[model samples]
Target chain A: MGRWRALANAAFALAVLALGGFGLYQVATRRWHVQPTFHVQVKFSTVSGLEAGHRVRLQGMDAGVVEQVVAPGKPGEPVELVMRLDQRLRHLVRSDAIARILAEGMVGARVVEITPGRPDAPLVAEGGAIESEPPVELSDLMKRTGASLQKLDDLTRTAKTGLEEINAIAGSIREGKGSLGKFVGDEAAYQSLMSLTHRGERTLSAMEDNLAALKRTWPLSRYSDSRSFFEREKVLYQPGSRRDSRLFRDEELFEPGRAILTPVGRTRLDEVGRWCKQASQPQSEVVIAAFTNDDHDVDLAEVLTQEQADSVRKYLIEKHGIDSAGWFRSRKVAAVGFGTQVLRQQDPSLAQLPPRRVEIILFTPQT
Target chain B: MIARGVWQLEQFGRFVGFVALTLAVLPRAVVERFGEVLWQFEQVAVKSLPIVLGAGTSVGLVTWLQTHRLLVANGAESALPSFLAVAVVVEIGPVLAGVLVASRMGAGLAAELGSMRLNEEIEARIVLGADPVPSLVAPRAIACALAVPLLTVLIDASALLGALVGEVTAGKLSPLLFWRDSLVFLRLSDVIPATLKTAVFGLLVGLIGCWTGLNADRSTEAVGRAATLGVVRATLAVFAANVILVPCIQLATEALGLGLL
Candidate 1:
């Protein structure tokens, strides 16, 4: 049994040696699959992780494996890879097939995948090469996503901050705290209303005075005697001087020598003065003071007392019945109307002083 | 102290035996003893053609697809040949060949040697005045050395074939144009270094397996251990050789002014 076993071993050894020799012969003669059934080559910019013997696939089906990888002769050119595929697959492939590198998944397992070419193209020959298409890398996608997210975050934050600032401005305006507040609030509007009221009042008063003067001159109806009254006043009063230039012509009456009180004028004034003296009491001098919203003037002319003015008015009403209340109310009193010689003729300096003028003003108040 | 010294001496003896057998191995003598190393070569390298071709073809297809993908990204997918040619010639040919040999032949050789040692045949040869080193060790060593380089060349060729198949299958390139471009840039350096590295790897496989078998204890368990250790050591040595040799070859080539050409 041992001898037989040894013989078997020897036979096996011999067979192995014979086969090995045959294989060697085949290698030398280039007989055993030396020529490729079909060939293809591809190029790449970088093959940093890829190596020869990496598997090649077609739609996830294994087609072949990598044979070789090489750098180009020139700089900045693609590195190349050579591959061989099964002979049976030659008919399916066309000249326009695309080859690409892809990762197995998110982490990575580099693989080369080939897509079949257009059916219209000519059938591929043995030992052919193909062009490669670039695939998107995970790192690139991640970078772009991160940048976009960051931009979105920044935009949202900016919008939020702007909205907050606007809210603050609106709140301040509601509270009426700033310049905008003054425009929006009611106090300034109320103040403007009060100023308008004062202006309206002054306008109305001036219009009323004008209306009163018109009422006296021209009555509204036929029975009214407003025109007759105006005619009576025209006859009773001396004709006031008429001048083309009114302001300059009025100065002539105040000239020293012009219209000096004559004897007839003095006798008429004395008669009026005697009646004024008889009507007025020596102890009880009635004083009429004129007051306005704004006034500091102390003296102008010797003004009549209330009693003297009342006596004159009574005498006119009882004897002549001249109703001149409109004239009285309309006149803006500058000085008291008095007989001219009885006037003290105070110096202009004394008249200008407020104290001395006040003393003189006490004796002749505005009626 | 004496026990430690004796252990050290035994380890040193084993190392020396390994070296001596490696140096003494003869390819022609191994062929005579094992009815020609070609027999083992056929079984180890020839039969491996299908697997090598499959692997190489797959590698080529993958490389073609990847390179094309990248080239398309850069808008330069046309220059596939030169790239593939240089890669196959310089890197993939020898390294993958070594890996294949280690996986297929290296492990088998160690197991066979371990089984022989366990069977007492090795002892019997020693008693009969037959040197096991020349008989068993030399044949396996020489066979591996011869087979590995030869297998590497086939692998390279198969890979190129696979690349062509991929291109044709994809219909992206013409076979004639691919070869023309690939061959245009290929050089002797690409071929020589690959074969040389494969041979070196083969020698490492034989040396590691034989050394482990010869140093194993008399126990059956020791033989098993030796075989497992042998495969492990051989694989590691093959990887180490690749790492060291590639850089050395690159430096030497550069020193000689060899580059892309």
Candidate 2:
């Protein structure tokens, strides 16, 4: 019985030893998963909070562990972190991929987070060094945030001062202390200003009519007849002839329903001027015809087109000095407004052609 | 009250002397009566397995449950096995085994020795030219010193198993994964020194138990008192030895450049 008891005791001891040995074996072999792994290195400017055994994550998924943290051997050299990542995830770590050390929580362990490269990028080879971005120090972030807050405070103070100045100006206007205040406050001044604006408009219209009649009377009469003939034949002219026309959309020239040229329109016109100078012949005539697609009100469209044509001619003659009196005397430039009539005459079958447009036609006498 | 205090201090001084004497005589005792040491080993260690395993498993489960909840809040639930393993293997398992053994075996040794002293058996040995220190104290002390470390290994294994059970029941991890993750932070430096410290705990338990028992007065009531005193003193000695030994081991490992701790 005593022998049996001793044997039992020995067996129990063996069992205990076996249990402990098994635990030790698990620890030593690291038999968690049979998946293969490969080694890679990443260099960082500062690995302050990182440790050797901390996890390495590939795009937020647990991939492997940091094997070693090697301090810089030479001054100014970055710290090297050796990592053993799963072999299957090798494709994720590409040549262009970057590894960053990130704190898991406010006070938790730091982990290496690898941002994947483009799918087509070459895989990071074994023993190769991948790129690393140094973790943004909390102090640096706080300093930058503090500077931005200071700038915001200054901006608020400046805005407050500007608002105060605006308030003072508004108060002056309310009290009838400025010219604008007088316009609003005094009935006589407001009536006079309105009458003056009306008179100016009437005078401008009268001058335009006089100018038109003058052009038809004397030295410009021959040029006006030639331009009218050119306009009449422009639609029926053969395509192969030495005649080129460039079309500019309404949005390219002016804002909707307005005759004023936009900056983009001015730029387009500059290009046209350059092209005209290049293509000009001794007998070449340049015609600027403005058209509108106002099916609702043809009269208003005609007026708008005429005003737009005049504006373009005046800008070229005054701003660009493209007048007949210039050294380039061979070029003859004229303005004409066809409004919706041009659309109806050109393509009568189509219900709608396009938006408002300006066509610049350059014609040389077909030799 | 003053006399009682003096008497307690004297007893403590004698106990310390007895521990020193036991250490001095250990090598000769092991050589002379190794079989007797094995017998005591089977009695003290084998008999104490159930209670030690239970303590270890319960402690591990509690640790895992509490740490899991805490780490889950921080999104670090994956680190639970590693934390529990390090905690159990390096600190909790050895200390728990020591304390348990001290309470169970310390009381038993004290009562047995107290009864023998009361019956004049120790006097009979001395009269027969057999030294009571070698025949009586040495075998039991050596057995305890040897058994505690082995028992600590058992405790560590049981605790790890318990952690596995806890993790599995929580439905967050598989047994295989838990076992793998548990080794993440474990180091040889942590395991070796921690296991070795239980030997010191065992030595303390044996010396205190025997000292209290042999010093008991010749009465039936004295046997009970000796047993109670042995348990209390041995338990305190285990804690005190841990406090001293832990730092010493830490410093030694650091000096050796192990850096495991």
Candidate 3:
């Protein structure tokens, strides 16, 4: 029994060695499968990492291995891949078979994927070449996609410019500029400005339309309101709305003509800040308006108040951390600065260091 | 202390010469004592099969589990099989076969020869006009040098099977898919050399075991020390040889124009 056991052990060891040796022999010969096979050739414009031992698949079935790579002698010449396919599956390879090189599992070994031809098609002759397709390289695809996107972006820019020109032409006709403007004259512009003061309770869309009409008025271009303060003013002046006003003197908010905030101004605005957080709703509109009475130059007054109004708006949004964006609805905040009134008389009424004031107006829709 | 150091150096030189002498006479010894070689093969390859296979399976399963978790996070779960193939076939299998043999067979060789030395059987053989080195040492050394590469091949196969089984449990890839992907990354160039390199490891194990046993003190306790020292020295030699052999093999393959695949 012991002698037999020793024989069994020796036999088992020899078996393992035999199996291992056979596997090594198969691999060294570059013949992965044992099936009798016939050779076919495929030519590719480019083959990335396609070696002699890369797999060959017939309609997604593992058929054989790439036998040899025949490189072209010169540039622009195709690389030829010699493949061996199982003789049993020889009928599947018709003369019109399409061969493509694809990567296995996203980044694995490159394989030659052969799409079998139609059943009616004749079998491809042994050692015959098939129709080859170039691989779709990711970098080339990206380049093509990028070029397409750039073309789309350029088209969109041209479209936007065309619309802007059309818009300017329409405005020119209303405000009386160019040949087309002489027909409608300034009466259309005057009518739009008039409609702004009397626009009644309307839907938000109608409000936008009215604002668009007002924006088309003469001298409206020089207003320079990025926040569309005129649009917010129309929304604020609804009937049955309660307006609460807080006034701070120019000395309280700024240093002379500049818009920079002072410590005293910040301290005073804390009361308004508390009102903003506690008393404000999503529907409420807060408008910061600064009035200046600089005696001689109305332009100086306009510049001072404009800067002050902007400064107050910046502080209100930033210092109090009033979230400008919300999921459901956003806060409607506006800032406008008004210079001193221009009188009809040649000489304007002047005051010496008259107190210029900043007003924070909160307009809530009547509940 | 200086004299002791010089003596130790001379001892090392003798060990080297003994290894060289064993290699020089290996072919003749193997042919003459073919039966002894078969018996040692029965002991080394067949008996050591269970441990090597179990270690291989565990290595594969652990490697699969680890590479899966890591690659899945990087959105490269597709690369698991390729990574597993390269890791196991190219690096893990050879080293593991060496270490496993070192741990198992190293001490067995030491104790077997140690007992003979303690019994003065080696002295008796020398007196009887027979050299124990050819009769005993050469056959065991030949067994290991031949057996280790076979075991390494077994381990590689078992580890790959373990990975396939792991993939089955994971259900991420079918058996056919895992196999296809696994084969896609395996190159004969890497597999052949990596598997064959363990022969050096086996030679080290046999030499160290024999060297320790023959050089042991005459005391009974010296046998135990020899056995323990056999495992430690053989295991260390396997690792050190692997470190040296890898670059040498790389350069050799490159010179042969079989540059690393």
Candidate 4:
């Protein structure tokens, strides 16, 4: 019985050793599954917290792990990453697939996602390199957005300031403050406007008469030859009338047959005798300035003549006819008061002029 | 002064006597003459098997149930085998064997030594010039040191089997995968450290038993007191050794760069 008991104990010991030994043998030589899996490589400037065996996911589904990392270049250049994917997804991955890192949640792990590439792209191979963008970290995105918002705020402030200035100008017009406001709002503006209507009619009539004179003198009007003759004739036959005086200042402004102005322009009568001597002098390079009661035109015609006034009239009658003078009498100008008010309000310097007469200055250019 | 010197000499003589007598009675001679040690082992190992197996199985089952209950929720059920195998091989097997061996052999050693002191047999040995320690304590120490490690191996195997059964029942894994894949982590580091811890446990249990027994006085109460001290000290020493040994082994393995884990 004791021997049987001893045998049983030995058998139990053998069994225990066998069990442990078998387990140890299996542990030593056990083979794990190694399938051929698809993978892609990405490069980054810095992979801050990334590590091998950290999750690689598609959308949100975990598909692989980071396999290897290499820093081939100097520190600032991109760091390359190699990832190993599961075998099941080999068929789905393509060459042109764009992979990017994405945040999983408000504060969760980072994951890689392959946004499907163009459908026409060729199949991606195992160990093929993939291009990917780094995820925008929370702090970085916030910093960029904050800067953009600041720029937008500056732009908005500038636009608001511009709008406010425009409003102030418009408000001034509504309150009848500036020249435009007075023209549209004040009763004195209407009176000045009526005066401007009369002045405009007179100026039109004068321009017509000048045009008729030119028409009659057209045959003898050589651009160079007549310039001295006209300058001389004007000096010899100066009219005896105040060129700055208004013909009538009556308050019954719109009454028919009223003359708005009757002024005689200055004539150069002494220049007629000097014509032969001054003929080759290039007419002193004649310059004339024309101003309204408002701002001057700055650009106006200049003329030079050296003929006697009666001789120039005879030259006009012989060269052209009476038809031009009749056309001049009927010319009447419209009443806008546009030039009058500009002179009156903006430039206080021009406020002391005759209300209607246009000023013309003639001069030669200095050498 | 001479009396005090003789008294110290007597204690030394007893310790030497235990060693000499234990060596004189060779294991083969003991087997040939009485077969007492073998008989004692059968009684201890076989009688203790049920409780040992029960404790191992229950520990494995509780570990599996609790760990998988939490791990499955986190999708980490596949890691259960690695968890259970490392835990059992490293810490649980040695600790359980040490605790149990201390209770079984330590108390017995203390009791036997205490009874001898009380009966004046120890005093008789001193009168004869044969010391008491060689006669009484040495054989117990040798036997415990050899036996405890073997028992630990058995316990470890039983517990792993229990863990496997629990894993299968829980439906968290397949029995094939458990046998094939899970068993792959049991490397030499795992086994060597475990068995080494068990050997230390055996030496500790034996030392605590011998020390407490020899210190006992010749009183009825002293016998009980010595046995109690033997179990307490052996259990505490086992725990203290574990605390020191685990970190030491971990550091050594890390320095050597020997294991994958």
Candidate 5:
């Protein structure tokens, strides 16, 4: 009986030890339905709530366990996590795969979630580092969301203020306070403007009728032929161009108070003739104007200036053999005289240089 | 009022002295009567296996049922085995084994010692030149201490088995799958400390039972009272020790960088 008791004790002790040893083995090797696993590392900037022994999941399926978490030791170095993933799921952990620390549930355990890379991507090498995204902090998200809401509030307030200002302006316009209000609300002013516009329209219509009549007349008919209605009416007092004008002094090109060209004038005219031949286009127009500062005898000064301009035209046509009929595409070369009318009002320095002068003006129509 | 308070303080002092003496005599007892210790071990561990198994299975089944309902509501019914495994191995198994031992074995030890005291058997042993501590207290304490951890292991295994049964019955989980899932959350850090703490529970049960029994008056009524006092005190000590041990274990694991807690 004593021997039986000892045997019973030994058996019980052996059973107990076996149970304990089994438990220890299960815990140490994690041998329950164990599968082969491979090691991989992931690096994170901040792992805050993640720890070693946390579950590692592949596309939300349980695949592995976190073996170790090495915290950042130096500045700018990321926290490294060593994970042992099941060999069956190794294909999911490719070189381009990303690992993120995520919560299982709102208040449940945190897990490492591995997002599978493209199938064509190379398999992750043993112990290779996988990319890691740090856990999203609720507080930081809230702060950013709060800032966006604040900006939205401010925008709404500003829009409201702008709408109020627009309303005020509309009210003022309705009350006939500003110019636009008068235009919209004052009946007398409105009638006066209407009448003025009507008169202007009538005047424009009459002017059009007169211009039509002038175009039908002998000399101007040729100028109005083939012109579009949208073309602007040509004005006689159009601005002059200093760049296209060539000036000749009376003493250099003509005898004092005389209309005939001198020897010196012929030499100057020769240069002008060459310039006109070179610079003038087929459609260019030229004007020759002569001015005299002999204000004591206005009629004589005018007659003398006209004669001198005519002489310059004659020299350009007769002496240099310039074409008068078809020169510059049938545009006539005109000669005009102004007797002391411009010299009295001109700059004193320019008036002192030469009182009697002629100007050759060139006109080139803009295409 | 003053006299009552003084008597209570004296009782407290004697309890402390008894615990110290038991601990001091433990090595000598083991060295001298190793065979006797093994016999006591068989009594404490082997005899108590059925009760521990029953309690563990019941606890695991109840835990699975309740946890399944809660987790199913959240679409997490699959996590039941993992949750049950962690709950049982880390906490429920060891604590339940400790309490069961304290209630059943503590009462038995107290009654046996109380009867011996009442029948003057302890005095007879002293007269025979045997120290009561090594001959009596040491083997019981050592056996209790040794047995509890083993019993805890049994509880863990039985609880896991119960969890498997529950999973297979309620869900489509196979036995192998359930076990695999169960071990998902089990870690050495949590298992080791939780299981070892039951040894402390065992020591408390032995010391308290022996002390209560030896201190009982030499009467039949006192023997019965000693048994009741032993169960109540030992059960209370188990719970109290659990509260202290859990935090101490947590602190120790944290200090060692285990991070189990």
Candidate 6:
């Protein structure tokens, strides 16, 4: 290298290296060519994966990093985080400055986001503690989610049963059974109906055979399966809590039109009586709802169904020895007569399956 | 085949000897011939900087452009600054800077020494009171080892600047926010070891260049061959060094408690 070229190169090299070295020094010290900083402490019940060296923002502006994490000394004590804030921005962090721990993005690191206090609020002293809002507890959220998922699983099971009933009703309509079957008057339409009926029966049988396979098909099946893996009757009819319902045909519960119990009806009520022994409590409730299409007059339909519901309620209290009333209060045994008013719009479930029926439902309080 | 193996073994043995000799004389040569070392440092570091910055800037700009859309789609545009900072600082900047330096300095040093060897200048120096290894080769070797770390730092800065420019112009993030968020994931353990490893790459460039040129055949064609060999070998060495150094440095940081506050 020549002397003059070396001199020029040295000057250039000195300038570049000096600038780069100064920038590096500033970066290493966390002072990005700006003013100095002061310390502030904030205590959080949970940091939500917030670590030392994570960023602390002031009103979403990048301010500083968490300097030290002093873990709680005893049980139930909050984790204390020491942060270094830019001294120039001290006016923004007041006595009422609220610090919250938030995530940067869906999967990014945790950040202590500090929203500034009112302009009139007094500025906190150096090394002062800022007020904090505790982060959402993951365990509590998971517990609530588990409960919600349990309810959702129950709904999914009921929806499955409803859909199966709809399939059966649709098959019945194809075979000239329900109101929808009135369209099939032509011979060609009848042949098409016959073909569709066989296909529906085959599909229904397949659905019945692959019931467990269907449980594994949906998106939330894994979560649902883990939540309630027991038999449907056992899980759905847990003894002293939630609800258990049984449906009996109107003829099975009462004489053809007289609201009187037959031997077969008595035998059926006995099984329910056994279930009530485990499922009933002093505060437990039983509902007997009866429906009938036997009477043409709406008022007469209402009376007949009402009488049938009353008779079942009476038998449960008298024969099964269930509680009714004492002095101040009574164990509620509500008997509602839906009559011939299937009102498919109001109670679509009533319009389908078993046109004349009575339902017994038991509701028990949670332990 | 046996003869070729013997030749290969002989070459390997001589290479090891040269490496040992350079290591032994390095400290003394650096102190004694400080002026020559400074000149060589300027030649290797300053002169090669423009290309390094250009490469660094383009790499960072392209990385940001590619990543920002995906981040925005996922509502993670906020993570772009810190994400780019960690990637460029710890991995991309050092190795790319090392290779750029190697490409320019490796060929230059080899050709310079090879021409001198062809002209019998090294022989003339040896005939005098001066030793060729210390007076000629050592200064270049020391300069290369020192220059790479400095260049790596420059590359890191320029790449961040390039990414910052993209983010500000297109993504609408303030420069201040970008600068602040960029430091969130960076630490001494990551930056120090990553930049320091480039110095090893520089040492390889200088040594291989000098070794190839000095051991070149005494012909005009050999000078060109030496220059080509210098660049190829140095570039490969830098990449290979990175693969080995990363795990070693990671282990060292954990063992030394560099991760703790």
lDDT of 2 by residue, B21-119 (tens): 778889999999877877898888988878988988888888988998899998888888878898999999999989998999789889999999999
The docking category that best describes candidate 5 is incorrect
Tens digit of per-residue lDDT, candidate 6, span A204-275 = 999886875765455454455445434322322435666667899988877887799998999999898778
Query: What would the per-residue lDDT of candidate 1 be over residues A247-326, giving only the tens digit for each residue?
Result: 11111212222323334433443444443344332222222121111122212221222222333334434443233223
Put down candidate 1 lDDT per residue, B1-261, tens digits, no spaces: 999999989987877766775576674465467664545545566567678778877888888888877766775555676678668756887778777777776667667777777788888988999777777777667777877776666666677787788778773679877765565334444456656777889877877777777767777787777767877888888999999998888888768754322
lDDT of 3 at A319: 80
What tens-digit string does per-residue lDDT give for candidate 2 at A21-49?
76666554452133588888999989967
Instruction: State the C-alpha lDDT per candidate.
Output: 0.60, 0.82, 0.81, 0.60, 0.83, 0.81
Better of 1 and 6 by TM-score: 6
TM-score for each of the candidates = 0.40, 0.63, 0.62, 0.45, 0.62, 0.57
> Can you tell me the CAPRI class of model 6?
incorrect
Cα deviation at A106, candidate 1, in Å, is 28
Look at candidate 2 and tell me the lDDT of residue B10: 92
Off by over 4 Å in 3: A18-33, A117-123, A170-367, B1-12, B71-86, B111-121, B170-184, B187-193, B216-229, B243-261
Instruction: Give the distance in Å from residue A23's predicted Cα in candidate 3 to where it truly belongs.
Output: 5.8
| Candidate 6 C-alpha error for residue A55, in Å | 1.6
Q: Highest TM-score: which candidate?
A: 2
lDDT of 6 at A70: 91
Clashing residue pairs in candidate 2, if any?
A: none
Where does model 6 exceed 4 Å of error?
Answer: A1-4, A25-46, A58-61, A70-80, A87-100, A114-134, A137-139, A151-367, B1-13, B164-171, B174-184, B254-261
Off by over 4 Å in 1: A1-367, B1-13, B25-36, B218-222, B254-261
Q: Is candidate 1 or candidate 3 better by TM-score?
A: 3
